[model samples]
Target: MSADDKYPEESGRRRFVKGVVGGATLAGLGVAGTVSVQSLTSASGIGGGPVEAMTIDRTGGPAPYGMPQVPIEIDDEGYIRGVWPEVDTEEVQGVEVEIAREELGGLQYSQEWFQYCGHQSYEGLDPNFDSDNYFKSDSAPGYDWQADVKDEGDRFHIDDFDDYEEWGNDVGNSGVGKPATATWRSEDTDNVIPVVIIRSSRMEEAAQESEWLDASTDEGVFAFVNKCTHFCCVPGYKRTGESARYNAEDRVYCQCHQSVYDPFNIVSTLYIALPRPQD
Candidate 1:
């Protein structure tokens, strides 16, 4: 590579971000490192700590890890919903604490995976937040076609994405996937959990080779938290034509910081999940 292709020296803040990214990459690689028990419990929350989570691969820019995958299930009625794991209490540090945790896709799936970026305090994160756990349409959607097909708060039906096999927009290539914007576990709550859903044949092919993907996704459909790990900014897949400049035209791109994530390269990411507020 030529010097012209290299990024210039970064400032202290950028250096710090890169350092954390490196550590997270190592953790995902199963290179065990030690963190003090005090550090894990220092934060003021109930369940924050190093959590094993399934995420879309972070291929470029400064995000420390991929966006957390939201395990989903399609109902008999053909509506899709995010899977909230079973709720129960566990003794941690000798005190009983309520948590949403269960084994799925060969992993300890838990609410801690979504406990970060201040989402730790969302009422919906409560193990028993009263809602059907369906992915509801956002009032303001990213894709124009979504607004045309469904109204705000309408549950998405699989038939809504019948064109996914040949879906196209002005942003990226055609037949990549069909996308949607929605909220999960947020009905009647002050805080909304932003979510992104995509239906693609590519996912169908990948799931065949991955145990985690097979259990978390269904019929080529999957969802993830829309927040970028870099700075909590929302990112989108094939939403911006400008992503071509960063060579991210076909991936989830965070315009705010030029981060890119590959949807098809899902991997296990060990990330520090923040704890929820005390009940």
Candidate 2:
């Protein structure tokens, strides 16, 4: 049985969040990396209750964003392979090769970055499914997002490469500028992952300097799991309207709690809860 099947009340994602903030001690959870609870609580002041909170203290100079390290393995070919089975190995390898050889900038929008895996469509998903029902809010934005997907005869064929160049390369477009997204399915697991590729103008500049490239900058290509770390919500890319945030660039926004995660530096901060209030 899958981890989710064994733990019906809480999926792996929810359990992880709970261990961090729901008054559970972190000593034996076997979480991937080390993160100091004191650092997170001292930085964000997200104390009290069983929920994990993050606030950008605009008035408090710079809010201390602690980097949460995600363990990643690189092959001899410079491909990024995650320890988790949900990761798409072939896709990530191709991307890493392109980036290492500096051929990523020449890639067309119709390339592998925009290919959708044919496991299932969001429309066919049950909103009440365990994966979708974990959010605290009743209104799951994914439902509306699925509805907004233009029908292309086949539900699995969600991506339209015809306008990809115009939407991804054109900076003036109001929608997510310079980014393309697609969905991928893992053969080893039931996880349906969403991937986004961002083409930044800074890539050329960074390439010329011979310095380590920043994933958020123009000189890099980044791909990450679409699941929101906060509540396991599948964040929509470039979504607009009252329910969505205006993401003009390559960013992931969770509609449930309006949690914004930068795919480029997602590991930069770890959010942990302080000691639980005395009973």
Clashes of each: 1, 7
C-alpha root-mean-square deviation, each candidate: 4.6, 16.6
lDDT of each: 0.84, 0.30
What TM-score does model 1 achieve against the real structure? 0.87
Candidate 2: which stretches are off by over 4 Å? 1-165, 168-180, 183-185, 202-220, 243-250, 263-279
User: Residue 181: error of model 1 in Å?
Assistant: 0.7
Instruction: For candidate 1, write residues 1-279 as lDDT tens digits.
Output: 234221124322445555666776676334213223432554345877688898999987777789999999999999999999999998877778889999998889999899877898999999988989999999799899998888999999999889999999988789989999999999888889999999999999999998988999999999999999877899988889878777788899998767889987788998877667776
> lDDT for model 2, on a 0 to 1 scale?
0.30
In candidate 1, what residue range of length 10 has the lowest lDDT sum? 3-12
Give the TM-scores of the predictions, in the order they appear. Answer: 0.87, 0.35
Tens digits of lDDT, candidate 2, 1-279: 344321223223445544444432233222212223432333321111122211111111011221111122334534332222121222231221111011212321111111112212232121122221111111122333333553311112213222333443222243332343433322223444444434333333444553223322222333344544434455544553422222322444555534455443332222332221111
